[model samples]
Target: MQPGTFELLILIFIFLGLQAWWIIPIINKNNKFNKRGKDLREEIKQLEKLYKK
Candidate 1:
């Protein structure tokens, strides 16, 4: 059976919603990882300065 235009639009929205649900968490995780990496780099720089003294 062929889908009507309204049914097609609904299907498209559902697909887009599912894609966003899967993608949003991954984006959030990457941001957190990037922030942690920056923090660690700063800590390392401080440690290196202490060692130089």
Candidate 2:
């Protein structure tokens, strides 16, 4: 059986929403890690400076 226009629209919306829901958290997690990475690098640099001094 062929789907009607309304049914197709609903399916597309659902698929897009589900994709966003799954993808958004991963994007946010990567953003958090990226922010932390800078801090970690700074701390490592400080440690190296202390060791060299």
The 0-to-1 C-alpha lDDT of every candidate, in the order given, reads 0.97, 0.96
lDDT score for candidate 1 against the true structure: 0.97
Provide TM-scores for the models.
Answer: 0.88, 0.80
Model 1 bad stretches (over 4 Å)? 1-3
User: What tens-digit string does per-residue lDDT give for candidate 1 at 1-53?
Assistant: 56598899899999999999999999999999999999999999999999999
Superposition TM-score, candidate 1 onto the true structure: 0.88
**Tens-place lDDT digits, model 2, residues 1-53:** 56598899899999999999999999999999999999999999999999999
Candidate with the greatest TM-score versus the true structure: 1
Off by over 4 Å in 2: 1-3
Residue 44 displacement in candidate 2 (angstroms): 0.4
Candidates' RMSD to native: 2.8, 2.8
